[model samples]
Target: MADKRYTTEFFLTAAEVNSQREMPLSRLVTTIIDTATAHANKLGIGFDRMISEGISWVLSRLTIDIAESPSVNRTYRMTTWIENVNRLFSDRNFEMTDAETGRIVIRAHSTWMAVNMSTRRPGDLTPIWKGFDMVDGAPSGIDNGGKLLPLSGSDFEMSYRFAVSDIDVNRHVTTRRYIDLITDLWPLETYDSMRISRFEVAFKHEARYGETATASRMAHAESPETATAQIAVADTPCCIARLHFSER
Candidate 1:
């Protein structure tokens, strides 16, 4: 067969929303990854197949930029595709639109590293790329994801006990749930006091479902206005997350 491009569609539901009653940004990321994986699977190139080969796709970093919030009962369309492949990582981009107006609501950019499951380290993606066809154009360069939190320790430390439902098809905690768990650790007072202006995260390791995650905040003395947070399972750092809050 000839090289080809792929895309998939998914709908959002009320259960995915956050306290503000809009679809949670983290859930949006989850949908994107799920759709992209499905597209890859249509070509016989997906995470499960890679895992069977002793390899797995690890989301190393991601950015999600939201323009408007979707209300309950509204159906949205999500599309994802492989934008390009770097030396060791493949870049994936996603777009979400209001199904009725065709207005864009959110966009996301993510980088995934193919790693050897046995060694638990970065591995060449060439083997994986061979299984799928390449797209023709470069990724749309728009910075769709949220900004990274500044280097500061003023952020507070939070903790969450994982639930069984957090597990994905891979039998590990789903990436979206981790975002929820991390953000949930933030004090209710903080959300009431400020608005999250931007957020960024880098996933370094996977936490199995039912594990406990301790999230701690770190602030930069030089710039107390900026802060970052780190979430870990026991002593192993699972994710490095940063959130910027604009004073209300």
Candidate 2:
């Protein structure tokens, strides 16, 4: 049987690290998304091929759990595979491990949908399901079905202007950019003292370049270390995320 998994190795560079010398969560997310796309391209069903056929893949949801964060110059390996494909969505899983110690640093799950670019509607994925090598289980112990409940009210609010560089080939703000914007709301001191244990996000609408959007965050009432955030363009909600943190 053909191997259903694809693995890639990476060495964290100075550019990818934060002031604390550890890999930033936002940059790690970018690596994960890029690696997944590269693997799909190798399988002959990536963005370029799908866009040429008038369809494109859109990320709907993502969940990541981190056990440890690798520091600058640290080498790690990431393995990704398709867990399953349904009529509307597909589940992709990832595992990132420390190359030296073989310890799991992060595990993530994501849901994606195939959309008809012209009609701006979701396309049936059954026809292309055969092209993917689907595995039987998820690499991350957590499932991708968790929902991000709406925030009661925002503790902080700010405006964001989308730049040209923020847009992706799909003509919308990139997923990694959105995460960077959300995480930026917190002070650097928070990151210095607290580490994110779990993170979840749901993409609701597309934000185009040159658009001004508002971002808001609300801390959980019971768990002070947990918070939820939402980014919206005018009145239209673009994305929502929940973050869980632990003191270092």
Candidate 3:
């Protein structure tokens, strides 16, 4: 039987770094996502298999906590595994550690479901999943942060028109694009002084190319260092997120 957990070692590059030369939170997400895909493929439950069955995987919820982010030119090893599985969803967790120091840099948890493309509804996982060899370990620190509340108000909004480049194989806006839009809310100074400690997002709807959308952010009153944000198209929210920051 194949190993239940998967690990990948890679070096951070300029393309994956932010203005401060550290891994951007979005890239941290992309790293885990890529590793997850590779693992799923190895387990025979990946995009290729699902698409052949007229379905594809969709992210339901995500939570990430960063202790320290690897800077450009650093090598890191990331491990990911299935934390749990059910007919409707798969729970995944990830931990990234500095390859040289063996220090944990980040931890993340995510939920995903196979969805019928035509109907945009969840498809039964039993037929395809075939069960997992659940890793013998703990999951990420943060839980799969569930559905976030609607934004109370927009301190300010950034407008976007999904373009040809924003579309993916599904012919709709990709989750990465949503991350880009949300991450764009803060200025470079924000990144210089503060780092995202915990980040959570819920993917709610599908937005296609050529659609106009609004990205809004509001500071949380209870947690002055945190912010809640959303991306809505035609007043219909497609993605909502909460971000907690800590001084660097």
- lDDT, each prediction: 0.70, 0.84, 0.86
Q: Which digits, one per residue and each the tens of the lDDT, describe model 1 over residues 164-187?
A: 888877788887777776667666
- Cα lDDT tens digits for candidate 3, 1-248: 66788999999889878898988767777777899999989988889888888888888888988888679998999999888778888888988899999999888898898898788788877767555554445667765665699896978799999999989976989777999899899887988898888899988999998999999999988888989999999879999999988998
TM-score of each: 0.78, 0.93, 0.94
Clashing pairs in 2: none
- lDDT for model 2 comes to 0.84
For all predictions, the C-alpha RMSD in Å is 3.8, 1.8, 1.7
Can you list the residue pairs that collide in candidate 3?
A: none
Winning model by TM-score? 3
* Winning model by lDDT: 3
Q: Could you give the candidate ranking by lDDT, starting with the highest?
A: 3, 2, 1
Candidate 2 per-residue lDDT, tens place, 150-201, comes to 5657999999999989998768898777888898889999999988888888
| Candidate closer to the true structure by TM-score (higher is better), 2 or 3 | 3
Candidates 1 and 2, the one with greater TM-score: 2
Return the TM-score for candidate 2, rounded to 2 decimals: 0.93
Candidate 1 regions off by >4 Å? 1-11, 144-152, 163-171, 187-197, 209-211, 218-227, 244-248
Which regions of candidate 2 fall more than 4 Å away from where they truly are? Answer: 131-133, 143-145
Candidate 1 lDDT for residue 77: 81
lDDT of model 3 at residue 190?
A: 88
